[model samples]
Target chain A: TQLLEQSPQFLSIQEGENLTVYCNSSSVFSSLQWYRQEPGEGPVLLVTVVTGGEVKKLKRLTFQFGDARKDSSLHITAAQPGDTGLYLCALGGNEKLTFGTGTRLTIIP
Target chain B: DVKVTQSSRYLVKRTGEKVFLECVQDMDHENMFWYRQDPGLGLRLIYFSYDVKMKEKGDIPEGYSVSREKKERFSLILESASTNQTSMYLCASWGQNNYGYTFGSGTRLTVV
Candidate 1:
């Protein structure tokens, strides 16, 4: 089974602070995706990175796939209260997705 | 936007009772998946169906069963609810393009 581990299971920061969460794996993945989940709701896709060393930006969030395709990271710039949610990373191939443990982020005012 | 709907948002059942969780997708996706989310275990796939009446067991399928009678609807069944089975159950569907899986709001089940 493919397993993805995420660091800093819980994070708390003041608004305007920058934070980065890392997702690491021993096995390589064909593609990786980032998702944000609000309380009592399913996760929403944030971005997907398919190529090694590829980086994609969505507004204040930036996602990068590692050069070995075995890791990824999500960086949030100037975090806001709205960014307080659970962040999940998923790796996909062959039509199945393996999700990470997830990071719970809280941005304080 | 793709829409996935689950029958119940919250459910409470007693131990040894049979429970059913239903999921439906409006996008006519070919693949539907059932997952359970725990505090530190993340989302673990319980079962998945690639087509009508065809099913595959995922990582954690020991205490669960799934039924897919039609293309758009999939159901997860617990033969006998247990306290260990209490968790947030999620449903997701994916189209042929493999763009991404769209998830439903999820059902929080409590077995007491």
Candidate 2:
């Protein structure tokens, strides 16, 4: 229902570059999850943030939730080829019901 | 490691044929879900089962049905396959230990 909107539908950058993707919504969210899906595989949940203004880090990846809880951002530093995948943001409504328009990132070697 | 397994990696079937996609999870999770993914439109939930014989409709449940006879296995049945139904289907289960849904490799189905 267009609840979540992700920026940069497609992004390609050189290896070792830094990048950030955004997921925004006008409706407030109770909790949000970030997932990475490689080609030919189901998406894997990277992290979940429940509190407003919360931040979580996984290796070179950094995730932040907005203070209003209506948006989130994912930043990657010194990205590698292995960082290439589609990043999706999902809202935990009734039961993790909705997904954002994904950002497909490609880190070129 | 705990796993969610889908029966077929790929399938090609004639239009109007009945199709069955099977999924099983070994984690003994209490919840299981089915989702179909497409190119631009992300993953859309088709159905989910919370417990044995307890099923719930998701965002896009039209033209689809699910059966969970046991705690481990869940099935998605297409009463009559159509070209529109050709998409990558995925199965997932939620576990308290895992803290998130673990997905199957996915089944890419084609209708001719």
Candidate 3:
């Protein structure tokens, strides 16, 4: 089975600061997705990157799939308190999606 | 916007009691899933359905069962609830080719 590893299991930063979190795996992937989950809610999809070296931006957040397809990163510019949540990266499989352990982010205002 | 709705936002049940958690999706998705969320474990899949009356086991399906009687509703059943089974349950529906799944808010179930 393949496993996904995310760096800095927990993160805290002052509002307006920039932050970046990473997701990695030893196995190559065809696609990867990022999601954000808040308290008392299920995870919501943020972005999906299919091509190696591809990058997609949503407002102040930027997501990139590694050139080797073994890693990905999410960068948040001018982070706000609303940006705080658990971030997860998932890989789709035969009939299900495998998820990473997740990175909990806290943006202090 | 597409929506996946879970029956309850919170629930409390006694150990050994049979519990049923319902999930419905409005997007007419063919795939529906049940997952349990924990503090460190992230979201662990419990069960899923490909279509009505079609069910399959997931990563963790020991004490749980699922039902997909209709095309839009999928229900997760706990044959015998236990303290260890207490967790936030999430329901999701997916469209083919698009990996961005639509998920319900989640039902927080506590077994005492």
When 1 and 3 are scored with DockQ, the better candidate is 1
B5-69 per-residue lDDT for model 3 (tens digits): 99999999999999999999988888999999888888888999988999999999999999998
- lDDT by residue for model 2 (A47-76), tens: 988999999999999999999999999999
Among all candidates shown, the one with the greatest DockQ = 1
**Candidate 1 clashing pairs?**
none
- Candidate 3, pairs of clashing residues: none
Model 1: CA > 4 A from native: none
True contacts kept of 1: 0.63
lDDT of 3 by residue, A47-100 (tens): 989999999999999999999999999999999999999999998753688899
- Residues B1-109, candidate 1: write the lDDT tens digits: 6699999999999999999999999998999999999999999999999999999999999989999999999999999999999999999999987567899999999
Interface RMSD of 1: 1.1
DockQ of each: 0.75, 0.63, 0.73
Show the lowest summed lDDT stretch of 10 residues, model 3 chain B.
B93-102
TM-score of chain B of each: 0.98, 0.98, 0.97
Can you tell me the DockQ of model 2?
0.63
**Which digits, one per residue and each the tens of the lDDT, describe model 1 over residues A1-109?**
7879999999999999999999998799899989999999998888888999999999999899999999999999999999999999998864689999999999999
